[model samples]
Target: MHIRPEQAGDSHPIAELTRRAFARAKHSDGTEQDIIDRLRKRGKLTCSLVACLGTEIIGHIAFSPVCIIGAHNQHPQWYGLGPVSVIPAQQRRGIGKTLITQGLATLEKTGTAGGCVVLGDPGYYQQFGFMPSPNLTYPHAPAQYFMVRSFDSNIPAGIVRYDAAFDT
Candidate 1:
């Protein structure tokens, strides 16, 4: 399978894939797709990637800017990664991994991103260099589930506020 940036026509399929992918997830509230749509509408999707086998899009990942409100009052180019999805039939084939790998690589290449934060399983995200930092926390969730993968040594400490689209 190949991974590439998402195109305009891939939106609907991505939505369907996201819905089916997270339909039964223990932590999903069933609005993952809607979050994507809102992010797109608000022009906050910093990076969106899709994994495809031939002409079919099988997996997807999204990244958006996140605000880090710290005591230092520094707002770096940090981003949030989430809603990664692979169709149930294609799950566990490493499509999700490929999508994340490619997406993060793209962000790093741009040299504009400070790092990325993800709210997910520590075991799964740890492989991607994501670790819980006492300095950075998301108040809405447990500290263990919120992980950060800094591109450099400077990992900020503070409350991470995802885009307003995620508030719902």
Candidate 2:
């Protein structure tokens, strides 16, 4: 298996993989794929990565700029992680984890080390240093499901807002 940055032709497969991965997820709103599409259309998809087995893309992860309401309303020092998808057949094989690790590392290198937030099971995400942060929030989602990974130990206290596409 190879993990790498997404290229020109990966979009369609990424969308398919996303749809198939989240189609029946208990917490999915059935719009996971659409979120990514909207993120791209609005030019907010900052980092998108894929895990490929041979010539086929099997998993995908997307990261986009997040706005910190109140105090730190400036250039994005943070990002949001979501719709991390691996085909049903590929689930439980570490593909999602691999995509996430690679994606976060790439984002950190880009000077976005402020942090990244994810709405996911703490059990799965905690291994990556993600923890429930009452300091940050996404109002529409359950607070307990919101996890954060602060790179510089500077996790800000603010209302976390994802791109407007999330509302679409």
Candidate 3:
């Protein structure tokens, strides 16, 4: 399997993969594709990566800017990682992991020390250093579903907000 930056042509395949991956979930809201569309329109999709086996896109991941505001009115650096999807047929093959690791490494190389936030299973994300943020909260989601991983130790704590597109 090869991991590479997603190109323009990968959109359709990626969408299909996302749909298939989330179709059977109890919480399928059809919002994953919407989020990707909005992020693309806003040009805030920092790093979109895909894991491929030959010409097929088996997995995908995206990172976009997020902000954390502290009680003292301090706004620290951060980004949100989300909507990670692996084609249902390929779920256990580590494609999601490859996409995430590659995407994060690319973000770090670009001087993004703001860290990353994700709404996901702690058991899975913990493997990548993500943990619940004691200093932050997401009103709409359970606290346990929200997590943060600091890429730099100096980032301040604050309310985490994703781009407006996420609200759609």
Candidate 4:
């Protein structure tokens, strides 16, 4: 299996994969694909990657811009991760982890010091250096679900807001 950046033609299959993966999961809202579509249309899909086994797309992950609003100010440089999906049949094979590792490496290489954030299991994401930021918060979501990881350690704390596309 190999992983690579998603291409234009991969949209349909990736969407289907996302839908199927989340359909019966614990948080199935049936909106992940819509969020992805909106993010792509808005040009906020800063990092979108897919795991391929030959000609099949078995997993996908994306990262888009997020902001933090602190007591003193708001930061708009940070990015957020989300809506990561792996084909149901491909789950438990580490495809999601691989996609995240590669995507984060690419972001760091591009000098994205603002770092990445996500709403996920703390234990799972902590392996990637993601932690709850005392200075940051996502008021709309559960406290534990909002987490961040700074690539440069210079990003300030504040309310983390994902791109508008995520509202879909």
- In order of listing, the candidates' clash counts read 1, 0, 2, 1
Order candidates by lDDT, high to low: 1, 2, 4, 3
| Candidate 1 residue lDDT tens string, 15-130 | 99999999978889999999999999999998999998999989999999998886485545999998899999999988888888888899888887889999999989999999
Q: Which has the better lDDT: candidate 1, or candidate 3?
A: 1
Give the Cα-based TM-score of candidate 2 against the true structure: 0.94
Q: TM-score per candidate, in order?
A: 0.97, 0.94, 0.91, 0.93
Give residue 53's error in model 3 in angstroms. 0.9
Q: Ranking by TM-score, best first?
A: 1, 2, 4, 3
Error of 2 at 138 (Å): 2.1
Task: List candidate 4 stretches off by more than 4 Å.
Answer: 71-76
Task: Report lDDT (CA) for all predictions.
Answer: 0.90, 0.86, 0.80, 0.84
Best by lDDT: 1
- What are the runs in model 2 whose C-alpha is more than 4 Å off? 72-76
lDDT of 4 at 63: 88
> How well is each residue in 19-110 modelled by candidate 2, as lDDT tens digits?
89888688777888889989989998888888999999999999988888874544448899987999999899888889899888998887
